[model samples]
Target: MAEATAHSIDQDDFTHVVKGIRYPPVVTEANLEAMLNFDIRDDDIVIAAYPKSGTNWMLEIVTKILSAGGRTDASSDDMVGKLEFQYPDEPRPHHVMLQECASPRVILTHLTPDTAPPGIAHPQNNVKVIVVMRNPKDTAVSYFHFLEKIKFQTGQKRFPSWDEFFQLFMSGKYNFGCYFDHILGWWQRRDDPHFLFLKYENMKQDLPKAVKTVAAFLQVKLDDASIETIAHACTFSSMKASLDNSRYRGRAVNARKGIVGDWKTMFTDEQSRLLDSKCKTKLEGTGLQFNFE
Candidate 1:
C-alpha cells in the first residue's frame, strides 16, 4: 500500500515479496511469522490495500479528517511499520514495535486477512481496518509502470512487455498473487465490525461524500468547512502537484495519471477480453465488482 513497492521488484526480480512469500500475502515467511506473533492493541486503526491502490492518498485523507483543524502531517507521525525490510540486527521484535507506537496508532499493510499480523487480524483486537480497492485493470497498469520504474533503478530485467505481464497478472504470478484473491480475502470480512471497505473510483468521483463517510467510520467529527478542506487536499490534482510527490523518483511520482479507466490506453483488445473473462469467473458469487469504465 503506502509501503516500498520498488524494493521488492529488485530483491526477487519480481518473483516474491522477499525470498519465500508470493503475492497477495506478499511477505517473507520470516516476516509473516514475526507478524503472526505480534501482539494486538485495543485501539488501532489499520489501512489495508494492494500497492498502487491509492494507499498514500487514503492515508492523507483519513489523517486530515481526524485532525481537528484539517492538519495533513498527523499521518507521518503514525507508528505503523513502514513495511520495510527488518534487519537481522534490529533490536526490537515486531511485537515490540507495535507496543511502542503512540496511543491510537494508525497502521498500514498490503497483506491479505489470512496473512495479516495477528495483532491487527485478531478476533478481539478491536482495531479498525479500512481496505481500499481499485479495478484490476487500472491496478495492473499502475503496477506495470511502477515495476518498469523500479527495473530502471535496480537494473533488473524488465517484464518483457505489457502482454506478458497481463498474462502473469491473470495467473496471479506477479509480485502479489492473484488480484482476485487479495480482494476476495478482505471482501469476506465485510461484515466484521473491524473492517471498512471503500472503492477508489468512488472516492475519486465524489470526494466530499467519501470524506464524510470516512469521518463517520473513524468516529471523527468535522464541520462542512473542514470537509471541504480535506476533499481539496486529497484531490488527484492537488496530490500530484504537491512537493512530496517528487520525494520519490519512482512510480509514486508517476501517480500523475491516477484516473479511472486508464486501461483503455494500456490494454489491447485481447488483453481486455482476457481480464474480463477471468475477473467474471473468479469474482463470481463474491458479490464484489469493479467499475472498469
Candidate 2:
C-alpha cells in the first residue's frame, strides 16, 4: 500500500474536507519493511497520542527531561523533528536535519493500532512507548479549530462546522478511525513492561505526579527542583505563552488554544449529548471511559 492520496478541495468547500496528506489504511510495504527491520536503540521512546490530545505537551515534557543537563538550544521545532512519525514512510527532510544532532531520538506517531509500525510493537532493543489518551469531546473541539487554521493557511475552506465536525468524528470518518479503538488498542497493552498509558486528565490534574510517573517508566531521573521546573514548563498556560515568541515561530498555525475542556464552550448541550451517547455506545467494554460530560 502507498500513502493515501491528498484530498483536494475548493476554497469554498475546504471547511468540510479533511486536510493533511492521508496515508494508506495499512502501512505501506516498504515503510513496514524499514520500520520492522530497523535496528532500534534500547533507550529510544515513542510518544503516541490521538491528534489534539496533548501529544505535543508530553513531547515537550519528555524533551525537557531528556535534555536537562544539555544546552539551552532545545526548541519546539527540534522536539517535533526528533519525535518522528513511526508510519507513513515519507522521507522527512526535517528529521534528517535533526538526526545530525547527538541527542537520543524520541518518535511521535498517530498511527492506529493495526497501522503502527511493527518495530514499535516489537523493538529489537528495550525501547519504551508512552500512549496518551484524552476525552474525545475536547479532542474533537481542539481538532476542529486545528483544521480551521490549517484550511486558512492552505487557502482551502473545506472545514465543516462544529456540528458537522462532531458528526464526522463520532462516525469515525476522521483520521485514526474511531478514537475509542485507538485508545483501547494501546490500553490493552498497558501491562507490557515497555508500555505506559498516560491520561491527559491525570496529567492536567497532577502534572508533577505525571512527570514522575513518566520519568520512572523511562528510567530518567530528576531531582525535586528539576521535576518542578519540568511540570511548570509543561502546563498549558506556559506552553501557550512560550509559543508567543518561541523558536517554533508558528503560533498562528499550531498553538492557538491549549486549555482543557474547551469543548464545553464550543459545543451546544445537544451536540454534547449526541457525542456523549456515541462515545458511550462505541466505547463500552473497552475498560476505558472518557470524561465527555
Candidate 3:
C-alpha cells in the first residue's frame, strides 16, 4: 500500500487539479464536493493558509486555546478538518468522518477562499476564521523543503531539485496554486467580522500577543497565566518536541526552522528579485504588508 501510494504521489507532476486549483493527489473530486457542501457548526473555527505558512503552528495554538490549554489528540492529522484530503487506506473521505465528530470542529486547510466552503469565511454562518500569512519568499522556501523531506522519508521517486522546485513555485502550478492568489483571496475578506488575519512573523515575534488575540477572537477567555502557558506550549521547539512521528507522516516538515527570513539563505539574488517583483505588483494597492525578516 505504501508503494502504491508512493507511486500515485509521483503522478501528474506530483499534483492534481481540482476546480482549477492544484492539490496533492490525495484530494479527490468527490471528497472536495462533499467538503464544499459539508455543514459547518455556528461555533466552528477554521484556519486557512497557503501550504507551509505556519499552518500546523496556528492549528496547535488554536486547538490549545479551544481546550483552554488542554490538547485535543482527536484533532491530529488523520482528522478531517484537513477537508480536502482522502487518505489512501481510509474507506471514506475525511469530511465524512468529520461529520460524525462533535462540534465546534476546528478545521485547517491550505485551500483558497473560492474552493473552500462558502460559509467558512462568511459571517452568516457565525464561524470564526483565522487566516495566517507568511511572506511568499519564506513560504516557497519552506514548501520546497517540505516536499524534499517528504520524498526523503517516504522513499518517493521524482522529487524536484531546489532550482526546479522554485520554478514550479513561481509558475504557481504547485500544490495549492499561487501563493499570491491564495492569500490575496483571503486578504480581501479581512474586514469581515468573522475573519482574523495574522502574520506568521508577528506570531513568532510575540506569541503571547498572538495567543491573546486568538483567544479573544475565539471568545475563549484565558487568564494571563493560562495565556502564558499556551504561548509556552505552542512554541516551535515545544510543539516539535511533542510531535508524535508515528501518528503524523512527514511531521518534521511542519515544524522546520520556524523563523523569519530563512529564505535569505536559500534564495539567489535573481530569484529574490523575481519574487519581490511578483509581490510588489500583485500587492500594490492592498494595505497588507509582510515583514521578510
Q: Highest lDDT, which number?
A: 3
lDDT of each: 0.70, 0.65, 0.78
**Full-model lDDT, candidate 3:** 0.78
TM-score for each candidate, following the candidate numbering: 0.83, 0.79, 0.90
Which residue pairs overlap in candidate 1's backbone? Answer: 23-176, 23-177, 24-177
Superposition TM-score, candidate 2 onto the true structure:
0.79
Question: Which sequence of candidate numbers ranks them by TM-score, best first?
Answer: 3, 1, 2
lDDT of 1 by residue, 1-293 (tens): 22233222333433444332364222345666677666556767788887778777787787777665343345533534434223344565434565666656667777777778765655465678889999999999988877776666556664447776776677666665668888888888889877888999999889999999888888788889889898998887777665244433432455557899999989989888988998889888888888987
- Which structure among the candidates has the greatest TM-score? 3
How do these models rank on lDDT, best leading? 3, 1, 2
The 10 consecutive residues of candidate 3 with the worst lDDT sum are 1-10
Q: Write the per-residue lDDT of candidate 3 for residues 40-138, one digit (tens) a residue.
A: 888778889898897788888887887784434454443454777766677877677777876667887777778888778464656899999999999
Residue 287 of model 3 has an lDDT of: 91
- Clash number for model 2? 12
lDDT for model 1, on a 0 to 1 scale? 0.70
